[model samples]
Structure formats: structure tokens, C-alpha cells
Target: MTVDQLPPAPAGSPPPARPGAGRTLIRGLGQLLITAGVVVLLFVVYEIWVTDLFGAQKQAAATEEVDEAWAAAAQTQAPQTDTVVVTDPAQLVTDPRERTPTYQTLTGQGFAKISIPAFGADYQFTIVEGTSDDDLYVGPGHYPESQMPGEQGNFAVAGHRVSKGSPFNDLGLLNSCDSVIIETQDDWFVYRVLPMPEEIPTWSSTAPTRPLCADVSVLPSPYEQTVGREITLPSDYAQILPVPGISDATVPADAQRLITLTTCHPQFSAAERMIVHGVLTKSYAKAPGFLPPEMGEA
Candidate 1:
């Protein structure tokens, strides 16, 4: 019989297996997948371990240095005054040069520490100096135009609520009459929290003025066009203060120097902001009497 007609080689010559083709293909694909997985694992490890660990260590060292610098400055300028009075809020200053070594160190190391016992905040944070686009997610922000901690108008600080390192995590838990204390290398300032008016929406409100409802409706006015309207201060009377949308003309007048602590509300979402307003009660230099346990001999 002719070869072509020989019953197709008993119907099962094993199809002449493709000479290592399957093995070579599988080996190549396996190697590619393994390489990709290894690369991904390495990146995740770096992010979870190296970045966080090294970053945190660097920040801590920087903070210590900043604290030392601030202590030195206070010693030279104030000479450990027996008493610190807050008679004039406008006199308080946040001199860049006077920042504690800790402040400078943390700031340079990509974080800043913000502690307020009233709100239960004691965390290291990134610093965002303003409320603009370039200022989000970095840290608790310091309103540059606002007064310092002991200042008269309002020293406002804002931070994330649910971030792992939430610097203002407990701000929402504060009740009226709570004690809010902020500390640095040079001084510790204490404040008394107060209740904000119910009708005053959170600072996250985008309305041009206070919003009004049927029982608490806002009145229409021409002052809505004013510039710097977004700037809210502790001294602003409820009636004239820009509410984003609601209007009230008979709110109580502002009297005391204010310090406002703001953080994201409802835990994980940025949908709203919780605000804790306080009035400065006392302040003292960071002497032995004012130092925390961890501060050592400072």
C-alpha cells in the first residue's frame, strides 16, 4: 500500500509531538509571571516598610532637633518668666526662626506634630500651610492669615479625621467647656471649648453665606459679593460672619480671643468638618512645670 493510503499510520502515531514547544512555551510564560510578581511584591514591601519606617524615623529625629532649637531660643528671649499672661492676643507671633527644633525637623521630615488634649489629638502629621489645591493630604494646615495659638482673632487649625495618622481625630468628641491644650517646645496654651451656634453649618459648607431654613432661613443681602468672605474668624459675630449661605442678623457678638480646631467629620469621609472652638485660658513657658513626662529634663 502507498504510504498515504496506509490507513493513516494505524490512526495514532501520537501526532508527532511538537518537539519541546509546549515545555518551552510554558517555561517562558512561567518565568515572565514570576518576574512580574516579584517586582510587585518588592514595590509593596518598600511602600509598607521602607517608606513608612524611614520616613517616621527621620521625622522623629527632626522633631527632636526642632524642640532643642526652640528651647534655646526661649531661654535667650524670655529667660523663663515666672508667669505667662494672654492679655493681648494680637501680640502672639509664629516667628519662623523661633520654631522649635522639633517643628523644623518634623516639617522637613515630611510631618508635623499636633496635640490637643481636649480633642484627644496626639499625632504626627504632614503640614499644609493653606487651604488651596497645593495644601491637601500633606498634614494639618495652618491658616497663614489667622492669629497664632494665643492670638485674639482666631487661630484656626484643620486636619484630616480618619487618616491613619489623623492629627485631629478626637476634635469631634469635644463638648462645650472642655479643655483644649496645645503644646510646643517653648509654650503650652490652654483653652476652653465653646458651643457653636446650631444654625451655623460646618466650615465645609460651600455656600456664600449662612444657610437659612423655614424656621432658620437666610435673608438675602448684597454683602455676599464681598471679597475675603471665606475667611471666618472667632471674633466674627454670628449675624455678620459669612455663613457660606444662611443669614442671621441678630447673632451674639464675638468677644474673646478664639482658637478653632477643625477636622474631617463622621470618621472616614470628608463630606463634612467638625469644629471645636475655644477661648484661651492660660499659657506658660515649657519649663519643668509644663513639660510632659516624655519631655525629660526640658
Candidate 2:
């Protein structure tokens, strides 16, 4: 056939071309995936390495500030020598809101420093009043509903058990008779552990117990209402009044002036609480001349 006549042979349609479009699309997709993967990897590295490094530095700085506050507080004045006498059992009120209260700060011995040799928790923190939603963090604070540290009533203190700044992180490891000391402007109060149940129902009558009551009137709050109520007190009082636990008879009703330290039970969950009870044994007005060699300059 002649060259001019060959063109007329394919008048109706042309043959299908090869399928290169699929291959082109896949190559574009692969490039996009690689770019995305690189960006993700960079983000993880920043969080794992850079973010943590900065966070640790910030924590250290915060601790220093807490210590300084403690030191300043210690220099203020010694605790007043008010002889707290318990009187008028019927007149005593346990309702946290009813009592006239005094607030104090918890500081380290030399400075506002707190340390748990058992848990290796050594840092400077402050103690504030109230455990309302606004004030859980920072450090342990005295609950006004309870008695003061040296008072003849229960002195309860609460603190966070987890998180980096958790002042009570080692609270869980505290066994019976572990030492939990608090150093204030006046003196260092030492508490000895007493055997108690790990869990107590908040509403149970046997839940709250008075620890140190020289007289019925000296009670910080009403005994009938406060005993089993979900309140904090001195660890010493916990020995006399124990709530229902796996074992109840072991806890004595005569328990008085109890000191209670409460934190989360299973590390993170609020499902239960882990409590440590102690008895107030000795009060040292000044830093003891003979501290264990291990007790460093806090």
C-alpha cells in the first residue's frame, strides 16, 4: 500500500496505550510517605530527649525555691507555749468549719526541706491549709479539720503520691514503724508507726479515731462525728482508733491523738488509699546535737 492510503486504515479508533499511569501514581505516594515518616521521627526525638531534659532542670529549680522559703520560715519565731487543755466534751466540735484555726508552713530542717530516707524523697516543699480542688498539688498541707502537729488531737497531712514533684511518692513503701518527721519553725516532730488497716471506708463509724486526748474536752473535733469520718489526723492517734480492715480487733479503741498520712494506694489509681499511722514520741526544739551521721545538712 502507498503511504497516503495507510492513514485511512484506522479511521474508527486507536489501540489502548500501556498502563504507565498506575506506576506514576505509586511513585508519588511513596515520596509523600517517606517525608511524613521523617517528620514523625523528629518529633519523637524532641519529646524523648529534649523535653525531658528541660523538665528535669525546671524541677530542680523549683526545689531550690522551696528550700529558701523553708529557711526563712524557721527564722521567724518558736512555736508559742500554749498549754492546750481538753475540756467540755459536749462543747467540742468536730466539724472542720467550726474551730478557730492557725496555719503553719512545713519546711526542711536547715531550710524548708523535706526528705524521706526510705523513699529517697529529698526536696524543699511548702505546707498550706485546705485540701480543696485548688490545693492538692505543691506539697503536703495541714487540714484545718484536724489538729495541729503538736496538738493533742489527730494531725492529718495529705500529699500527692505520684507525678515528678510528688512529695509523698515513697509513702507506699512505708512499713509499720517507719519514721515520718516534720520540721517546722520551732522543732522537729518525730512519729513512730502504729499497726493499722490499709483501707477504711470513708463512711464507716470506726474509720476516724482520736489519737492524743489527755481529756475529752481537748478533742480537736466531736468524737462521735469525726471518729469514722474521712478526715486526717496525727499518726499517733491512729494506733488507738483503727477502722475496720482485714483485721479490726488488732486496732484499739482507746487510741488517741492519731497522726495519719494518706496518699493514693496502688500508685496511680484513686480507687483506694494507702495510710501510714504514727505516734508522736519526741519533740526536739533544736536540731538534735546527735543526728545519725547519714542525716546530712538538709
Candidate 3:
């Protein structure tokens, strides 16, 4: 057939480029990205709001369980208490060994409540017997290896700074001398954050928290009172030492009772850790018809 006379080539179907596998793949990839984005948004929601709600519920239940246990301990009562009257907590409350109530338990169940007035007068959480993932998911978790509250060693705890109820969300806001109280069925353990070393008085040859500082030097160093503090890497475990940051600290003898509060640094990221160190300034025994003055504060 001559060129002009050739039967009009069938207007062939559009070329492959016009509507091909590549276009379909591109469309599919776009859809996948959109779906992925939605999934990420949903996950963030679950991490923030959902986890807090769920954690609040879990903490409520945990507190109930702990309270019941406390009741049992209260009822079983040792009618006798130490003859030593606490005229002033800063001095009288000091007991190098375990103090009144003998409140220490290894069960996963919470045995006490942690109240940080700085966080808020109403802020409180149950402290369960471990810092394991499962333990922390419910509430603030006490390090299994750490000492109990009011003990003459590092009574350390780990909590979530965000999500899982964000129990320690405002931990960084805690200033020097701020109270980090622990209430057991038997006693009220009040610990004041210790100041940084330089902030300590010139008289103390060792860490002011240990070997017992008679003055206000026991409270957190002035540096710690600054609005925002430095973050430490996870590998920096000395923050929980008997005398925080002092690995060779002679605990119980050279060291006074202390508490170490730890949580994730910043907000959502776990890149580093936030640590708060305190000295046991008050150990008021929980007795029949009695509450510490701090607890009574409105």
C-alpha cells in the first residue's frame, strides 16, 4: 500500500508511557505514603493521650492495692514506737539504718506513694518494686537494687517524664530544697534535693549530704535550683550512688540517707536522662491518728 493510500493505521491504543506500570507504581507509592503518615499520627496519639489515660487508670488500681496493703500493716500494728520524739525532722529524723515501720517489699506491687509538692500539691504516684519496663508502665518504679525510702543509702527510683501518665513530667522543675516525699504505711520519708558540690559549705570535706551536714547545706546545691539543669547520658549511673556522683562513697557511715529520682530527659525522647538527688531530711513515723504537717498543707 502506498504511504498515502495505506489504511489509516488503527489509532493504536495510547502508547505504554501514557498509562503504564510506572504510573500505577507511582500512584501506589503515593497511597502507601499517605497510609504510613496516618499510621504515624495514630501512633503518636496512642503514645501521648491514650497512654496517659491508660496509665492513670493503672496507677489508680495500683494505689488501691497498695493502700489495702498499708491498711493491713497498720492493723497488724506494733503498738510500740521509738521513744525518741522528733522535735525537729532535720535532726531527729535521721536514722542511719532502717527507720520506723520497716517498710520494704520486693513484690511487683506498689508499697508506697511518691508525692512531689513542686510538681503540684495533688501530684502523686504509686511506687512499685522495680524499674523494669513492665514495672514502669504502671507507675514510677523503684530500682530493684536501690535502697528503700529513708534507708541510709541511695534510695533510687525511675519514672517516666512523658507518657505512661508522665508521672515525673515536671521533675526538672524541682528546685534545690524542694521536697520529694515518700509515704509508706508506716512513715513519711521527706527528702530534700542536695545542692551541687561547689554549692556546699566550705566546712564539709566530703559531700555535704554524707557525714551529715548540720546546716541547710544538705539541700540541693545552688546550681541545681536553676530553672533548667543539664542532662546526663544513660551510661552515667553515678547519679544513683550512695553519695550521688561519688562511686567510692562509704554509705550508711560516710553517707546519710538519700533518694535519687530519674526520668527521661526533655519530653518525648529518651536520648538522655534527668536526675534529681535528695537527702532524707525528715522521717516521721506514721501512727494512729497522725499525719505529717507537710501532708496537711492545703
* TM-score, one value per model: 0.47, 0.47, 0.76
lDDT of 2 by residue, 1-298 (tens): 1211233445668754543776557667777788899899997676456644553454455456655654555456435365344443323223322222233433321122334444544543555555553344445655556666644546677677765356666665564444455555444555545533332232133323433221112123223333222323333234223331212323233444456667765766676666655655544443323232222322
| Candidate 1 lowest-lDDT run of ten | 211-220
Q: What root-mean-square deviation over C-alphas does model 3 reach? A: 9.0
Off by over 4 Å in 1: 1-62, 78-113, 118-139, 196-255, 289-298
* Candidate with better TM-score, 1 vs 2: 1
Instruction: List candidate 2 stretches off by more than 4 Å.
Output: 1-114, 121-125, 196-255, 287-298
Clashes of 1: 25
- Candidate 3 residue pairs that clash: 193-220, 194-219, 194-220, 194-221, 195-219, 195-220, 195-221, 196-221
lDDT by residue for model 1 (81-174), tens = 4866544333453433244333332222322244544332343343444644334344566555555555444566666555323456666555
Q: All models: lDDT? A: 0.47, 0.47, 0.70
lDDT of 3 at 243: 59
